[model samples]
Target: MIEATGLTKRYGKTLAVDNLTFQVEAGRVTGFLGPNGAGKSTTMRMILGLDNPTAGQVLIKGKRYRELKDPLRTVGALLDAKWVHPNRSARAHLRWMAAANRIPAHRVDEVLDTVGLTSVAGKRAGAFSLGMSQRLGIAGALLGDPEVLLFDEPVNGLDPEGILWIRKFMHRLADEGRTVFVSSHLLSEMALTASDLVVIGKGRLISQSSTKEFVSRATENAVKVRSPQLEQLRTLLVQAGADVTDSDDGVTVSGMDSEKIGELAAANRIALHELSPQAGSLEQAFMQITGDSVEYHTGLEAEAQHVLEPTR
Candidate 1:
């Protein structure tokens, strides 16, 4: 298991990470999520001892990364797929890493095959495409078969097939009782892949929960109802203390669940054509939770106003 308590980092005047406290349990894939410049990369770096924390601590299996006899054998990471020698072949790159960690030479071939880079094993790292480079990075991470893995934006350059492969590969690692923590901006993919989530924003922990619980808690449940007497139903629903919104096909009712809405319609002698509960998507929940925490805002009006304003 991986744990961070009061973990913090600073760069001169900028505070990159706040007092983050969370645990990544074994045998599960935990997604680390945040908006741009949310300090996710910094936190991951601190976890791997790539950057010293300004305060607090992070540990893998109750030991600091620096204290490990063989750090790669205890914890594996792919923070940047391009952080390898450009002139080296994929196999050569893994070989170099294995040598540094004292990993067996046979493990290089095994990991290359595991990542499906056997065909391109001899290809130079510089010539490899983004997807191929990501595969090679993953191959390096797997060289030690470590019990803890950290992947930062592993799906950034992947196509559909590559994304699917990485998803299943993460699951397989977790199934083998490893702690898998992945950081990515792909919310939809994370929804399908991660069993739990660690959400941070502006360098502070916003939420830490299972995927299902987080979504359900962040989203407001609503019911979609359609009837011939749409106007009447709408009035009745509004009068019933439910907030309703008109849609193209139906009126979405909130403040109550589907069963309550159905009972109300029946009592009012209304004929219901369609009645369905709309569960919010992960993207929706993420937007709702991180709406204020977003650092970047884009607006044509804001830009135009800035340009038109008088200059001092």
Candidate 2:
């Protein structure tokens, strides 16, 4: 398990991370989410002892990262896939990391195979494609067979198949009772990959909850209702204090439940063709919750949105 208590980081005259506290438990994939410049990279660096926290503490298995006898075996991280030496072969890279940690040379081959980079293990790191480089990075992370793994944007520039492979691989690791914490800007992918989320804004903890709970709480719940008498249903919903938006097939409803909508239609003898509750999307929840936290705003969003709005 990984734990951060009052974790903070500061630069000269700048506060990068606030007093943040969160936990990453075993056997779960926890997503670290935040807007750009929200200090996510700072936090991850602090966690790995790459950068010293100005205040507070982050621990791995109850001990500071520096205190670990075999740090790589305890916590494996792939913060940047491009951090490897450009001239080094994939095998040469993993061999050195394993050697530094006193890991057997045989383990190097194991990890290469694990990440499916064994075929290209002899290739120079610089020559590898982005997808191949990502796999090599994961191979390094697994070199020590660590119980805790951290990844930053593991699928940022991958093809669909590459993304899917990484997703399934992380799940396999978590299923083996390892702690998997990853950071990414891909909301849809994160929603599918992470079971729990550690969301932050302005370097402060906004929420830490299961993926389902987080989305359900932040995004508006709406039910879609389709009827032959669509106009009648819209008028009824508005009169009953529900927000209604027209859709191609029907109307989307808020401030009312499916049961209530069904009752209204039945009472009026309106024929109902479809009634389904819309699931909250991760993108919707992120935009809604992180509206004020976004560090870089184009300010053109409103203008762009106005251009898209239909004429009344």
Model 1 lDDT per residue over 37-61, tens place: 9999999999999999999999999
| Model 2: ten consecutive residues of lowest lDDT | 303-312
- Per-residue lDDT of 1-312 in model 2, one digit per residue for the tens? 999999989899889999999999999999999999988999999999999999999999999999999999999999898888999999999999988999999999998888788888898999988878888888888888999999999996689988999999999999999999999999999999999999999989999999999999887788999899999888998999998998888889988999999999999989999999998888878776777787766768545434433344
Off by over 4 Å in 2: 302-312
TM-score, predicted candidate 2 vs. hidden true structure: 0.95
lDDT against the true structure, each candidate: 0.91, 0.91
Candidate 1 lDDT (Cα, 0 to 1): 0.91
TM-score of each: 0.91, 0.95
For TM-score, the strongest prediction is 2
Q: Given candidate 2, what's the lDDT at residue 158?
A: 84
Give per-candidate clash totals. 0, 0
